[model samples]
Target: MSTVKVNDATLERINELKEKLKISKTLILEIAVGNYHSKFFKKKEDP
Candidate 1:
């Protein structure tokens, strides 16, 4: 599980970007999760 905290201004910006790019909430969330995973695992060298 992950938790994100955004201020009102940031939330508005995200909403605006979502509308402008025509992206859905699900896609945004997936991208965020993928990014988080990559960052979290970046220190471990792959075999």
Candidate 2:
């Protein structure tokens, strides 16, 4: 499990992107994690 903190400005940007992309919060979070994992690990498979 992990935790993340979002400031008001960042939260607002997330909401704007969510609305523009028509994606749910859960999907957005999954995409974010996927991106982080790929960038940090430099691997397609999860650790």
Candidate 3:
């Protein structure tokens, strides 16, 4: 259980995406955070 705060402009964009995707705001946040983490923090495996 956690919380995230965003500026008005970011919130508006998230709301618009949620409406366009027909999904919940929480889902949008989860996807965004997951993508960010994967892009920046995911570990690479050694061959």
Q: Would you list the C-alpha lDDT of every candidate in the order shown?
A: 0.84, 0.83, 0.79
**Which is better, 1 or 3, measured by lDDT?**
1
TM-score of candidate 2 versus the correct structure, residues matched by position: 0.40
Worst 10 residues of 1 by lDDT: 38-47
TM-score for each prediction? Answer: 0.42, 0.40, 0.39
Residue pairs with backbone overlap in model 3: none
Off by over 4 Å in 2: 1-23, 43-47
Candidate that beats the other on lDDT, 1 or 2, i.e. the better one: 1
Q: Which stretches of candidate 1 lie over 4 Å from their true place?
A: 1-23
Report the lDDT tens digits of candidate 2 across residue range 1-47: 55877799999998899797776767899999999987888764565
- CA error at residue 9 for candidate 3, angstroms: 33
Model 2 whole-model lDDT (C-alpha atoms) = 0.83
- The whole-model C-alpha lDDT of candidate 3 against the native structure comes to 0.79
Task: Count clashes in each candidate, considering only residues at least 3 apart in sequence or on different chains.
Answer: 0, 0, 0
